[model samples]
Target chain A: MKQLFVLDDKKRTSPIKVLLNVLLVCILLVAVFWLSLSAINVTFDFSFLGNFQVRIWQGFLMTVFLSLASLILSLIVGVLSAVGQNSKILFFRYLCNIYVGFIRGTPLIMQIYLFFYIVGTAWGIENRFIAGVIILSVFEGAYIAEIIRGSLLSIDDSQLEAAKAVGFTKMQTTRYVILPQLVARTLPALTGQFASIIKDSSLLSMIAVIELTQTMREISATTFKLFECYLFLGILYLCLTLPISFISKRLEGAFNYEN
Target chain B: MKIEFYGLVKQFDDDRVILKSIDFCDDIHTLAIIGPSGGGKSTLLRIIGGLILPTAGEIYVDGEKVSADENELQKYRKNIGYVFQQGGLFRHMTAIENITVPLIKVHGYSKEQAEERAGELLGRFGLLEEGHKRPAALSGGQQQRVAIARAIAAKPKMLLLDEPTSALDPEYTTEVLDIIHELKQQGIDFIIVTHEMGFARHACDKVAFLCDGQLMEYGESSRLFNQPETEQFRTFLGKLLEWNV
Candidate 1:
């Protein structure tokens, strides 16, 4: 007989075990949260939710809009940069490298402040919402480019050699072979990146863009309900991200057969 | 086919020369390049196929110079088929699509024309029933056959086989080799890099023995195998053939 602690394929999961584990986890989380709340001598009051309902909904919509816009623009930027890194022109290749390096190396908060105040001002980008979308796209595009470029690089050299051997032009190879692979390999990560873009858009609050966090910030500042506002803000963001994360996971499972 | 090289060289680094001062002018059909591991056989074949450029020198097939420029090389590569050891079929494509995509995209065949040609080749290779399957779904031997079908889909002037059966077992190796022999019988001229000494001796018209980045011997296959010129090649043959049953 195998030891009790050993993992065995024959030892299948049971419904009761699953239910018990989930219940225990929920109880542990609530117990810890309750103990912390009592220790801090904090009493929650969510009555201000009635007054700021409209503003909160508007903020949520703005966050959604900002995320959607950023996701698309960043996807374009990501694909271009990923392809650029493989360019024959040294200038184009280095430009992609430096762009990805600068964005990934720096903190997002610093990027928001720098791009919004300095670069946006210099470029005469006066609209905060547009500036926020552009800033978020630029920030997230670097990470997406890395995700795409990694998949691009992981494609075997032999695949390319075979394409060349068959007389494919650069454009034809990209169309027939490389693009299909890039899509199959990067779809899950790109969907997951949408969730990250939504979360990252919250940083635009620093520049007074009325995304979810900014609206919550104003309400909490006025009503003196900081904990309640932030807690509700987290829940609101989760509502937006949870479905996207679930889709990303499903895509990951679906694409596992390509290998 | 006549393969002529003028001072051919390939260097990956300052000192890491893969092919060093290769000088050969040969007029032969059905050539096989046999060499020790890492002896630059595949690199030489790739250079000839225009898949890669040599550091310095030129390859002349039928007295026509193969350009080293990436853009110009495409014109040369289109006329030559290359089979890699791993089959190198596009992982996402079915066996038939692997053949047809190149025909339609590179050769400008209509979809019907490409598919018809691909179906004929797959049938000839005895893969008609399996043509709809992806490369991953096929066995190693089947994948290599699909790769071969993909290679010759557009009727390349000459085919380059780079250790095409190295990854297969004895049975699958025979299946791939049998198809290759049938291709030769159909007058599809080819140059192969292989370790099958018996196949190289019996099937090929010319044999070039490469070792340590140099062509150690080159001659008619039967004569060279029986009477290798270099002392090094003789010792090499002894070690290779000693345990053969």
Candidate 2:
């Protein structure tokens, strides 16, 4: 017989980690606050948020419009790529494979530069917003395509066969039975992709699209308050990303608890 | 309705033949095909369900030569409900949603009508309470029942069940068999591929013993069970009954 020692009557639970994590967060917040204050003089002015609010708000709107436009294009590309990959036809399968590889193999930033400078300029399109949206769509579409493909493959083969057995044509089966399940399964990935799109909107600054971070960069250059501007920008980015994160988590929880 | 398999042969490459010129006919409500493993029983069922084509022969459904025409085959398949060995439930849909799917997608029933029909079937299977549960949340037996309910919710003219109870516990086996027996009584034609001799003897109207991709023995359940005509069937029966003993 083996003898074991039980030190405590109760097992240690999440309490310590919760306390430590909160403390760590507070410490990080203090350090960031201290650095921000030390880097620039503290001035409480509501004018930037009010006087320049229109420009900032316009940039915010532009960011949202760019993200939405890119999302729509990416949705079409992603769905098509996923379907092509799942197609029984060899040509379509190979085509989708090549598209995924070509997009994912290259860095998004390089692609952005290429689209903005080479492609858009060559086409005589001066709008940076158009270039930004197109680049982001192509970049994110590849990732979204993979997510959709995985979800489609994750579906049971028997379900497809069952649909066929019921006299559903291939198109009908794909449209009705397969697509709904795919959408539900890929919901989280879509939310994640949307969050990435929000952060990636900051990259539009390079293209002079004057989105959130660009607005901050411009104001900070004139005001000489890089810390204050960035902190505000960080808070704004968090505002944008946090809701999407919350919705994704809620969707995941609902899906899991549905059964 | 009559289903005919005429000299059906399925060969892989030039050497191996899974089903060799197999000929069978059935107009009965319930036809059970019993055989040892790898006897091509499932291949036969798949061919009848139009899931797979016979490489050499033609299959006629209800006096219509339907196999060659792809479009006609699609229409013919509307009347069949195939329950694979695994429950093959969506795993994502609630039990009721899975059951209502065929009605909504293929039969063109409205969502409300589909749910109503599905609710009735779930109630019949004693799964009304479990209707909102996913397949993963349910026990194996419950999942199997949900699969069967989904199959029949389409009100298919025929049902093909492939070794449905093989993966189930004994208690659950009885539950499924009881449901099948009830379905048979309600005049739902069934083509069952089962290893359960007890279900074949008690529930199935007729039994066909297949071996080596051939129907070696087929007759009324009594004759096939008590006095199997061939030595191969006798060996198969002896091995199968040995487990029961």
Candidate 3:
């Protein structure tokens, strides 16, 4: 038993042992959930999946489209706000600061309603999908800006001085010294934020956006199969985000320099 | 280089005076400012490099007043090179790129011209093979040498090195000092803040000893090292050389 736990100098565990342990842990997780699910009065029925296939597929596609569109828009907003937060002009700095502060201080669900009902209505944005994407983009943009700003602040003052000493103009310094370092440090966090954007878009179901969650909600309401719908919903989300988290982990390692 | 300072003062946060009033002048091809740490040596060097603005003072370098305006400062900085305690090389860029990028971007050299000049400097500094490596991959001495090469690649009017070898081992320190000696022989003007007393005494023409926010002594390096003045400087030299072979 002791030898089984002990590793050789290389510290490499046997592949067979690792695989077996992983399988056992997965089996244990499923068993626990199955035991609870069996004890509950609710019956598990995925038969409705076949009946509502088209609606669910469309909802999943909507979620993907919303997350993808918001990801790109949020990233643009993030880079601008992050750089703006460090701007010499007070107006740019304060605007970025207040945006980040307000979005972070309040809840996202409140922001979704307020933006869709008040701001979106005021702006004549009648399409629920467009309003939902805009709201999600605005919300995620603030968090992304904070992530970028944190990495920006972590850059050494010496780097700036070195650039100045070499006579790099402000624009050139941003292009050469600041941007490369910024990309290297912030890429992983930004990728992780995309995962958050996917999860957060589910809340747009509240506004009747017809996304995956809304489709599932509608289906469950009619079928009275809440648990089955939600359980399958989680599996579908994992299918999207599990690969993202894996990529995020790989990116974190890829950017790791010894310095 | 004829350099003059009139009532130079630098304070941080209005309360901490890193440099009390400083008035000094010197005309030397190679100058070294040496003293204990936290003695305003690096701060004085930074003001000379136009990287920092003194709170109250006027500086004249080679009969030209170093102004605090942004445009004038950028122009002034354009003709000078500065090396910080760390190499301050872009960590993401390879050592050669560290030298070439600045030359191409800031100095307006073509990419080929920049690469040629960077290659020459790397070879001169014995970093030709290490040129492909980033600062993190290079050794401390290599990083500092790359910094020195980067600083001199544009052939600046003056080079300001703030303890370039402070982070290196004794072996690497000797190597960096040797490069400075070669630069001195080549007759490129420089101002260095260093703790290596022997290099200060031998390699440099003029020496300024700063301690406790004041310039206590300034003279020819040979004469000053041989015959010291000021009780503070005398004690400092004694303590420093006491451990020497």
Of the candidates shown, which would achieve the greatest DockQ relative to the real structure?
3
Model 1 agreement with the true structure over A1-259: per-residue lDDT tens digits: 2243334568775666667668888999999998999999999999879998899999999999999999999999998998899899999999999999999999999999999889999999999999999999999999999999999988888788788888889998888888888888899999999999999998999999998999999999999998999999999999999999999999988776565
Candidates 1 onward: DockQ, in order: 0.63, 0.52, 0.67
Candidate 1 interface RMSD value: 1.5
| Cα lDDT of model 1 by residue, B7-59, tens digit | 99999867789899999997777999998898999989989989878999878
Which segments of candidate 3 are over 4 A away from where they belong? Answer: A1-15, A41-48, A80-98
Best-to-worst ranking by DockQ: 3, 1, 2
> Highest TM-score, which number?
3
Q: After superposition, how far is residue A117 of candidate 3 from its true place, in Å?
A: 3.1
Which residue pairs does candidate 1 place in steric collision?
Answer: none
Q: TM-score for all predictions?
A: 0.88, 0.87, 0.92
What value does the lDDT take at residue B182 in candidate 2? 93
lDDT of 3 by residue, A95-126 (tens): 99999999999999999989999999999999
Candidate 3 residue-wise lDDT at A177: 85
Most lDDT-accurate candidate: 3
Order by TM-score, highest first: 3, 1, 2
Descending-lDDT candidate ranking: 3, 1, 2
